[model samples]
Target: MSEQGFKYSILASGSSGNCFYLESPEKKILVDAGLSGKKITSLLAEIDRKPEDLDAIFVTHEHKDHIHGVGVLARKYHLDIYANQETWQAMEGHLGKLDLDQKHIFQMGKTKTFGDLDIESFGVSHDAVAPQFYRFMKDNKSFVILTDTGYVSDRMAGIVENADAYLIESNHDIEILRSGAYPWSLKQRILSDLGHLSNEDGAETMIRTLGNRTKKIYLGHLSKENNIKELAHMTMVNQLAQADLAVGHDFKVYDTSPDQATPLTNI
Candidate 1:
């Protein structure tokens, strides 16, 4: 890693909760804070970070699993919260009372700089009022955090191309999801263009966006009941191989867990 590189960790990611910690030379922020405030604080502690050290929280959507802890963390730490106007309105009722100064809204598709890092939000296909994903750039390096989307449009794929690192969704395996214990309606929701991405779709998105600059790829947002880490990992590896890409030599794949944090990695 270079002196000006970016670093990040998946504090937790899944259907249960989804949060990520990212930092540039002059900034430290959470992409989302989906767990309980206490739990998120504990996870940050494991990485030797303190809540008081954070700059802000950037939300992907208003879903409970994606914004559960946003209000608590903001009130406790006096941190700023960034989201599109639509997402802010949808999540406001559930986030409790927040100080006006703590709320910051960013326009979709526009880049905003917190410090050394420049982040751009783009729309994603999800059930929320206005779901979004982000691309963070610093010192010519890019890191993308894209999850909770049913399908990646070609435009979105182009926006994230050549990222140095990625934490993208690989929610479930098609066969397992089809035969899993979930109700048929629920399965359809997960398979819809407005729902979550299946493992196969996630792999294809990776193959489309991957480039020479890509170094690490973290498969995230797995379903505990319908998918397992090994299955998601193997699915990605096999699909990438079919695209003439090697997992290790070309880029390493990592699995994110709902209960733990991935090692802080440089991008």
Candidate 2:
């Protein structure tokens, strides 16, 4: 990790929980506190970082798997918590009482600069109150974190069109999801435009997202019941192959696991 780069680790990402550790030389932040405070803190410690070291925590939405640890972590570290007003309101009953002063709201589509980073939030397709994805930029390099969206809009894609690295949701395979044991309504929901992205949907999104500037793109939010890592990986890779984009030579793709932090990614 050089002093000039931006770095990140997917602390945890899946249906169960979602958290990330990101930093530059002078500033550090966490995106979503979806796990237990203890678990997130422990993951930070693994990277030689502490909850107290973070400048802020950005909540993507009000879902339990996205804000479960926000209140606890905010109280523990006295950190700034960023979310839209509606999302903050939706999050309140679930996250317990948070200190009023700790809350900060950023307008969607506006770039907000925090310490050494510039972050822009854009609305994403999801069945939650004001769910969004973020683009983090510094030193002319950018890494985007986008998950839990059923589909990506062209506007949202334009916001993160030039990422150096991206962590995107590859939630399920259509066949597996359709034929699996989930209830019919649940299956329909997953297949809906506002639910979650299938492996094919995620892959098609990647094809549009891949550019000369892109280096690494991580496939995240795989469903344990409806998706396997190998299958999810092959599905996306095969799509790129059809597009004549070589994986290793053009860019890299890796699956993110719910139980472990992905390796440190520097951009």
Candidate 3:
């Protein structure tokens, strides 16, 4: 289906919660189920999909913001939940006793196939016990989603470079984070190697990894209180332009709003 159309939807993205739907006629997967069960169901309805339409739900980490609704969604929909072994362990408390029939655990650095989609998991620098990111492929089209990573590593870049569409985190502007109302301890955590990616760092990664095949870039996991969508867009646009890529005219750069369903679009 290389010549066939494939679609991906943000559904929702932000600090409050994050979830995405990726589909081809042969596969339908949800990257995460962070929002409430009702909210997730509503968002799926907006896209004309039902919870049962999902083939699997892949979790990036055990952060509450990313897995808040996982257990409920899984219990209600009985969807297969995929995660690295370590992540599954760390989240055992929240997940309680997962139904083996619906729990599909894999090790990091391994590739798993679901229908027409092939997914590869890679370790990312984040504070979670076993944080990871995902690279998804179907019909020769590839997309990488790496939110919550503190920084981009050489190995991580190798995985991201192959993606035609990259959805990476641009969590905050350093200036705002430094001067924001967050306390000293919290501030240090955000700036740490195991914290979150800064806006400038995210742009630098884009400048280095983006090639002609890259058509869309989504800045995800933004801080509602510390960062502005315009600022995040401008930061990436300016950096990419220096590399000779225009913003909207050359490619799409979308801000995943803090609490709204972004319409699904073809990559």
Candidate 1 segments whose C-alpha is farther than 4 A from its true place: none
Task: Tell me how far candidate 1 lies from the true structure as C-alpha RMSD in angstroms.
Answer: 1.1
What are the lDDT scores of the predictions, listed in order? Answer: 0.92, 0.86, 0.83
Local accuracy of candidate 1 as per-residue lDDT tens digits, 1-267: 366778899999999999999977788899889999999999998888889999999999999999999999999999999999999999999999999999999878989977888898899998889898999998899999889999999999999999999998999999999998999999999999889988899999999999999989999999998898998999998999999997799789998999798888777
lDDT score for residue 165 of model 3: 85
> Better model by TM-score, 2 or 3?
2
Cα shift from native, residue 13, model 1 (Å): 0.7
Runs of candidate 3 exceeding 4 Å displacement: 1-5
Worst 10 residues of 2 by lDDT: 257-266
Expressed as tens digits, the lDDT of each residue in 106-225 for candidate 3 is: 778988877777789999988998888888877677888988877898888987784678887899999999889999998888889899888888888887777777888999999887
**Highest-scoring model, lDDT:** 1
Which candidate wins on TM-score? 1
Positional deviation of residue 45's Cα in model 3 after best superposition, in angstroms: 1.7
Better structure of 1 and 2 per lDDT: 1
> Scored by Cα lDDT, where does model 2 land?
0.86
